[model samples]
Target: MATSTLLLHPVRLRIVQSMLGHAQTTTRELAERLGDVAPATLYRHVAALVDGGVIEVVSETRVRGASERSLRLNLSRASVDPDDEALVDDERVRAGFLAYLASLASAFDDYLAAPRSTLEADLVGFRQVAVFATDDEWREVAATIRDALLPLIERSERPEGARRRILGTVSLPVD
Candidate 1:
């Protein structure tokens, strides 16, 4: 399966997002995180990703007579390569992008609805700013942001007492 095609399905995308930044994960954990998805459906999609080479099983163990697997994403295989002919499908890309946005919105909604939810106290932020820059300057800005974030992005272990935080970014140019 083409990388884009494999990763773009809404459910698969959610799986990938849940796995991101984690060094290893199991289907049981994924089921807990994605409570709305049926366990069978989640397992099926996970199997597909494994078969497609997008995620690999790192180890397996028997727990209570059932084999449990630990898996991680193949980051190199998680992205849509420019050379992939599948990139020509604008509708596919659009649908996937919409799915991504929808997931973020849903996450935000859940956060807001939770008891004792306070945006300021939680350090939550949602804002947009327009930037004027030439192509080279824009590239520099993006590179700077990535460089600053690489350390945190590469960390797989969470700190003690640290809660999970979501940070999402989207860039669009309008002439």
Candidate 2:
């Protein structure tokens, strides 16, 4: 139940993604949002996350003779530690990346299933460009992108006109 092991699982990763930057939420709520996952399966992953210290139960209430627990991601314990990252083998990295790719594909499928007019109006896009830069320059580019997005990420909880959007980026060097 190491943080990285817990996170690398596809279901658990999806659960973490759904809970990121949000307030406390119940397992029932999670199951609802992840409508494709079985309730039992979702519950099992939630328990694993809780046991792994990646998430915690913030509150509990009795409802209809059953206890409903509200859980929140423990941001401090939700990342692969730098040292642990160095220890991850190639197989593990490949597995994690595949899981992420599967999720991305699923998201794209969902987008396509939506109304075509809505999709077109939303300014959605997928594109890639090759940029040549020194290592230091690449680091600066990454930092600048993060700095520009940090405010939007922080304001995700705003209840106004904000809509959910997924932004995915991958940078790799070609041999």
TM-score of each: 0.89, 0.86
State the weakest 10-residue window (summed lDDT) of model 1. 156-165
Model 2, CA-based lDDT: 0.82
Candidate 1 clashing pairs, residues 3+ apart or interchain: none
Candidate 1 C-alpha lDDT tens digits along 37-113:
99899999999999999999999999999888999988888766867888788999898898899889878877877
CA shift of 136, model 1, Å: 1.3
* Per-residue lDDT over 52-160 for candidate 2, one digit per residue giving the tens place of the 0 to 100 score: 9999999999999998999988878876674775336878767877877888788788888876676558878888898889999999999999899878766636778
What do the candidate models score in CA lDDT, each in turn? 0.86, 0.82
Alpha-carbon runs more than 4 Å astray in model 2: 85-87, 116-118, 156-159
Residue 158 miss distance in model 1 (angstroms): 2.9
In model 1, the Cα lDDT at residue 104 comes to 91
lDDT of 2 at 93: 68
Cα RMSD for candidates in order: 1.8, 2.2
Q: Kindly report the root-mean-square deviation of model 1 from the true structure over all alpha carbons.
A: 1.8
